[model samples]
Each structure stands twice: as C-alpha cells, then as structure tokens.
Target: MGIALKIVLALVSVILTISILLQSSNSAGMSGSIGGGAEQLFGKRKSQGYDAILSKVSTVTAVLFIVLSLILVAIE
Candidate 1:
C-alpha cells in the first residue's frame, strides 16, 4: 500500500509540473505597459479554448498534489 501510494504521488507530481508549465504567464510587464491602452480600448480580456481548460486542469492538479503530499506524510 505504501509503495503504491508513493507511485501515485510521483505521477501526480509530474502531472502538476507539466500542467503548471503548460499554463500561460500572467505577467505582461513591459509589453503590458505598451499594449494596455489598446487592450482597454478593445475591452475586457477573455480566456477561451485551450487556455481555459489548461488553467482549470492546473488548478485541479495543484490541489491534488497538495492533498497527496499530506496523505504521504501521514502514511510515513
């Protein structure tokens, strides 16, 4: 049981890492400073398609990672 739990934890860690990497960076920095005006004129930003799905997946994976870590600690 312990070994199986450890394997599941490892898989979840990998998934969490990949999902985080797949998500887009929120910081625009210099580019945002220049393009902020144009974006405002265009209106509110919308997240559609793959980005939205990836974002949700990242969130869920992150939560799973945390929960699994706690479970692993308890088992040990």
Candidate 2:
C-alpha cells in the first residue's frame, strides 16, 4: 500500500508540474505584476480552450497531491 501510494504521488507530482508549465503566462513583467490582480479580479482575463482545461487539471492535481501527501504521512 505504501509503495503504491508513493508511485501515485510521484505521478501526480509530475503531472502537476507539466500542467503548470504547459499553461501560457498571463503576465509580462513587473508592470503585469502590479495590474494583473486587478484584471483578474474584474474578470478581464478569461481562460479558454486548452488553457481552461489545463487550469482545471492543475487545480485538481494540486488538491489530489495535497490529499495524497497527507494520507501517506498518516499511514506511515
């Protein structure tokens, strides 16, 4: 059980990293850092197509990674 969990965790970690890397950057530079929050807050930026899918994938994988980590620790 422990070994299986470890393998799954490894896979999830890889997938999380890939999904994050595959997504397009929303900000350009220092200017974006300052105004990006306002744009997102006002719903000016919207995710579509591949970006949307990747965003959801990253979110779910991140949550799963956390849950799996906790479970693995508790079991040990």
Candidate 3:
C-alpha cells in the first residue's frame, strides 16, 4: 500500500537476485564435474577459501529471502 515499502522490497529482491548469481556452483565447475563421479556426490564442509564465502552468502541470502517473503505477505 505504501511506496516506501514497495521500493524497499524491490531493492531487496534485486540484491537477493544479484548475490544468488554471484555465487559459483557448489561443485568446482562444469568441465571438471560435469561428467559425474564420486566427487560429485557432495561438497566438502571446510573453512577453505571461496567455499566459505559461498556458504556464508548462501545462508544470509536464504534468511533474507525468507524474511522478505514474510514481510511481503504480511503487507499484503
């Protein structure tokens, strides 16, 4: 009903979209894991380099998505 809330939600949706895209695949990449093998079964859980960033980003994005969805529903 309010313009401010609409703008905020739009901005949030954009950020959520961007962040989700910035993240690389859980697996290394296509050329490497595309075919498939035991290595493809899962990703290792360690405080490694990029993976740590990905994991953290995923968590924040997920929470934001949930919160934003709830807010939109409540507003409606």
Choose the strongest candidate by lDDT. 2
Show where candidate 1 strays beyond 4 Å: 37-43
- RMSD of every prediction: 2.5, 2.6, 3.6
Q: Tell me each candidate's TM-score.
A: 0.77, 0.81, 0.53
Error of 1 at 35 (Å): 3.3
lDDT of 3 by residue, 12-32 (tens): 677767767876665556666
lDDT of 3: 0.68
Give the TM-score (vs. native) of candidate 3: 0.53
Go through the candidates in order and give each one's C-alpha lDDT: 0.82, 0.93, 0.68
Output the TM-score of candidate 2: 0.81
Candidate 2 per-residue lDDT over residues 1-76, each given as its tens digit: 9999999999999999999999998776998878677786787756678999999999999999999999999999
Better of 2 and 3 by TM-score: 2
User: Lowest summed-lDDT stretch of 10 residues in model 2?
Assistant: 39-48
Write the residue-wise lDDT of candidate 1 on 1-76 in tens digits: 8898888878988987888898787658988878786776787666898778888887887888889888889989
- Screening candidate 3 with a backbone cut-off below 3 angstroms (N, C-alpha, C), the clashing residue pairs are none
C-alpha lDDT of residue 16 in model 1: 79
